[model samples]
Target: MGFESVPSLPLEGLETVDAARRPVPASPGTTTTPGAADRAALRTDSARANGAATASPAPPDLKVVPLPVRRAEPGRDTPAAGRSSIIVLLQQVQEQHGYLPRPEVVRCAGEAGISVAQAYGVASFYNFFKLTPPGQHTIRICQGTACHVQGAQGLLERVQSELGIQPGETTPDGLFSLETVACLGACSMSPAVVIDGEVFGRVTSRQVPRILARYRRRK
Candidate 1:
């Protein structure tokens, strides 16, 4: 649940360009071409025959709408309060946009009357606050002393080579993000790497390609 020797930097407020950008619109266009309309009608009939759609209209499933998140307001509040404030703000941003974008973080901070530092402090403290978008799968390698003593470095190199990315970075195809954590507390199984939080302990460099292949198969 905790780690030591992890190299962490303070979170910074979102950039200006992001803050100024407009939210992306959802929903498909209703306007259709003559050809598209014919194709859609045929597909609809096929789907209905396949039981994908029922003859009688079915009620839409209930959707749980999340509450709007608000950022912390910088006051004489304690750091703990500030952290909660930041979390709230981030939640609001995510709720509105469906993801936490850096610019939104800054905009939310400004809207909440909090300082960028306050937002960054909270963002960096929590591992969940991703500065960049995550991949379909995430791979975390242990850099703890015990793991390092074993073959963690070699394992990391294997991952980098296979994924073509260094730690704290994601693949160009957006299939994986490689992160280095100080320790996973699996000292007994040194040189561990976790894919999607599932630990693979005593991992050797030779296993890197195989491990990656397994993940690729999943994708």
Candidate 2:
């Protein structure tokens, strides 16, 4: 089955949360960036925090994650940790763990002085928060007016067949994920797909298999 299209979210600054009991904060703007390597580190942290070990060829070892340098805007002061609101704290959690893992949510809820239900409510209210871990690759198919008229849905089906997973689903091996966006704003390039931050415009369904193979070979 094909996946329904949803609106796309632009990259923006994550909100802050009220600090209590030393709530752990997220690294700055880590969630929405093109820094794949950095995201990989956060995924590692998230996996470890959730007590799930990534089955890799090498034996797992304790590692230290280097913190990114915090940059200040020209005039605006960044919200200080503990002074920010719940949104920012949730952003931190998502940044650290890829998505808001249930256990971390409970912990943050307790620290934020809110119930677990309230926390889930807040997380659900925002389209930005993902409740589950994403695949190693995130593929966004454009289903905007132009793309749809240009046969974007067919492209989506081709991807579905190639991955054997529908949109909003990750492959069983956790290698690829599919999602449909209302528009990528690349109207000129009607049939468009973005794989792992690389935009392939004017894409055709025939190209889907080759594109997926390239990614598979990459990592």
Root mean square deviation (Cα) for candidate 2: 23.7
Predicted model with the maximum TM-score: 2
Best candidate (score: lDDT): 1
Position 136, candidate 1: lDDT: 80
TM-score of model 2 (CA atoms): 0.56
Model 1 bad stretches (over 4 Å)? 1-84, 91-99, 114-128
Q: All models: lDDT? A: 0.72, 0.72
The lowest-lDDT stretch of 10 consecutive residues in candidate 2 is 74-83
**Stretches of candidate 2 above 4 Å error?**
1-85
Candidate 1 whole-model C-alpha lDDT, 0 to 1? 0.72
**Model 1, 1-219: lDDT tens per residue?**
345454443233322243113344465874435674466567778778888844432222343344444444556444544555667778777666645687888876775566777777667766656667778888989998999999899889888998999876789888999888888978899988888989999999988888889889998
